[model samples]
Target: MSEPIRVVVTGAAGQIAYSLLYIIANGEVFGKDQKLVLTLLDIPPMMGVLEGVVMELHDCAFPLLTEVIPTADPAVAFKDVSAAFLVGAMPRREGMERKDLLSANVKIFKVQGEALNNHAKKDVKVLVVGNPANTNALICSHFAPSIPKENFTAMTRLDQNRARAQIAQRLGTDISNVKNLIIWGNHSATQYPDAANGTANGKPVTDLVEASYLQSDFVTTVQKRGAAVIAARKMSSAMSAAKAAADHIRDWWHGTESGRFVSMGVVSDGSYGIPKDIVFSFPVEIKNKQWKIVQGLKLDSFARSKLDITTKELLEEKEEAMAVCNGN
Candidate 1:
């Protein structure tokens, strides 16, 4: 067998971690043939829960899982890791302002970024799954100057997958028939789910779904699906979020099959007029271990307006974070 690939996951005591570790242990994310050594990181107070998770991992007796290490220190957790998933963060509590939430998460990501830069392997790819993921990813990328900005991405695949599944169900077709869906801008409520460029079995999605529904209801449904899930389950989203993380890393490290571009919140390079240095989701195609923004697709006026709104919101949050860091 080849040497084990080291993966570090932050927030190891959280619900998503519970859902994610099982898949990783079974080698579903990386592949069945590859062996894995997982380093699970959590806060000191959460170490007990992480320990419980470790015990469960052992119980599974997965052949592909070589070892599981749980720790409270980012340095220890990220040491020599091939990939780091930044899933831990200060969630937005009730009565908290957006600025306050961003400030708290910024501190958490900053330390993780420095640790990853100092201790992780040279090729570490980071996926930020925490709330306000795009801003948090930007903070981490800024702190880890040594790591390429493109290597730090926030999860938007969940939204993309949700859009595809919804479209598939509406059309009474399998998900395989859905293609070219794009989740643009931030991963939050302001995200634009573009079916304008999407297709179902080579036919434009807009052709199947009514234009009125597409213009109003479909976009709202995709953007607010998380809230709906929470309302129904009376719990936070865990399983689907974990699956999205896996899908994202798998496609990135492996490759997106022909004719598909995954949506990811990567640091913007002023593509599509988005401001530079902000982590914004775009329709991206991955090849040869790098992601390039999918260009030349004309956005209708409505899509353009929606993208602007989301990008502006992200920029404002980033500015507030910078002001706080500067003690303004």
Candidate 2:
């Protein structure tokens, strides 16, 4: 077997980590034969919990998992790492302002970003999964100036999956039949779940579903699915989020197959008039181990308006982070 690829995951003791570790250990994310050295990182206080999790990982006895190291130091965790999952962050408290939340996460991401630049492998691919993921990814990418901007991304696959599932249910079809769904712009509520390009067994989704419902109710449901899950389970989503993260990395490193595209929040290259440097989700086709924005799709007035709104929100987030850093 070839030497294992090293992967670093922050928030090692968090619920999402609990769901992610086992899958990664079994080579579900990388590939069945690919080996991995997993570094689990957390704050000092959570080290004991992380260690316990590491013990469970050992119990699984996955042959592809070469090693599991739990640490509190970013530099130690990221050392020679090939891929990074930035899952740790200060979530918004009950009454925290947006600026306060941004300030708190900036501190965490800044440290991790610097560690990535100083210690991680030359080809580190980073996925920011924590809340406010796009901006958080942008911060990390900015700090690691040497790393290609395209290597940094944030998760929107969850939203894409949610949209697919919702469309499947509404059309009374199996989820497997759904394809070409896209979640554009921010991963937040303003995200545009475009059914315009979606297909259910080779037919346009809009052709089979009510256009009004698709434009209004379906869009709302997809964007609000996270909150609905939290309300239904009485806890934040972990397993599904972890699965989505895994799917993201899997598709990214392996490649997306023909006739399918996934949504990922990558650093924009001024596509569709979105500002450069703002990380926004787009319909993307991944091949040759890289993502290319799907171009030449004509958006109707509704889709265009929704995309504009979400892209504007992402820009505002970038501005807010910049202002906080500037103490404005």
Candidate 1 regions with alpha-carbon error over 4 angstroms: none
Candidate 2: residue 55 lDDT (0-100): 88
Query: Residue 36 in candidate 2 has what lDDT?
Result: 93
As a TM-score, model 2 comes out at: 0.98
Q: Write the per-residue lDDT of candidate 2 for residues 233-306, one digit (tens) a residue.
A: 98888998999999899999999989799999999998887888899999899987789999987799999899
**Error in Å for residue 216 of model 1:** 0.8
Weakest lDDT window of 10 consecutive positions for candidate 1:
319-328
Provide TM-scores for the models.
0.97, 0.98
Provide the global lDDT of candidate 2 against the true structure. 0.90
**What does each candidate score in C-alpha RMSD?**
1.2, 1.2
